[model samples]
Target: MRIINPNLENKLKKFGSDTAHICFNCGTCAAICPLFETSFPRKFMRYIQIGAEDKIMDEKLELFKCLHCGLCTSSCPKGADPGEVMLGLKRFVLDKLRRNQDV
Candidate 1:
């Protein structure tokens, strides 16, 4: 896969998880998402799974739109925890952005 930035891969790897492997991309995150009544995490998960790194970066503003309310995490049958994924991905992306800015 084309990784727009490999740093995120390394950061994500640090979590050392197969936690997301079981996601199956079901829409439970969407259905239960307090934000999904307007915002969406389901589509974001798909982007991450496919290594759609540019799209992820391009859509950065949308990620922060999450209210961090935890409904999506609690309701996921696959334990996909979209809320955690959102937080993790934000850290992964913005950490790099901050590093880049300092350089």
Candidate 2:
């Protein structure tokens, strides 16, 4: 069961990509992603926008599939910078994992 945390966007900003909440789910990022047939950055972006923190953690491995070629960032009409968001998510997930290990 995924619990939604309304502050997820704010939490994500610390990792980087302060524009994480700017995405409007246009799917342009997914359309241009060369690494996966399924939606890549858009999926992550939506999770962030909706404050789906649990969902993000659950699907964290999918974040690594990003090639970070800048195509998604360049194609985003909203200037959401999906590539930057993905990088931020990687850092966020890593931090969460580290904190969990230390607990």
Residue 80, candidate 1: Cα error in Å is 1.1
Tens-digit lDDT track of model 2 for 32-52: 899756877788888888889
Best-fitting candidate, measured by TM-score? Answer: 2
**Candidate 1 structure quality by residue, lDDT tens digits, 35-75:** 65543888777776666777877788888888888888888
Clashing residue pairs, backbone N/CA/C < 3 A, model 2: none
**Model 2 RMSD to the real structure?**
1.8
When summed lDDT is taken over every stretch of 10 residues in candidate 2, the lowest stretch is: 35-44
Over 4 Å off, model 2: none
For residue 86, model 2's alpha carbon misses the true position, in angstroms, by 0.4
TM-score against truth, every candidate: 0.77, 0.92
Q: Give each model's whole-structure lDDT.
A: 0.71, 0.85
Q: Residue 86 lDDT in model 1?
A: 80
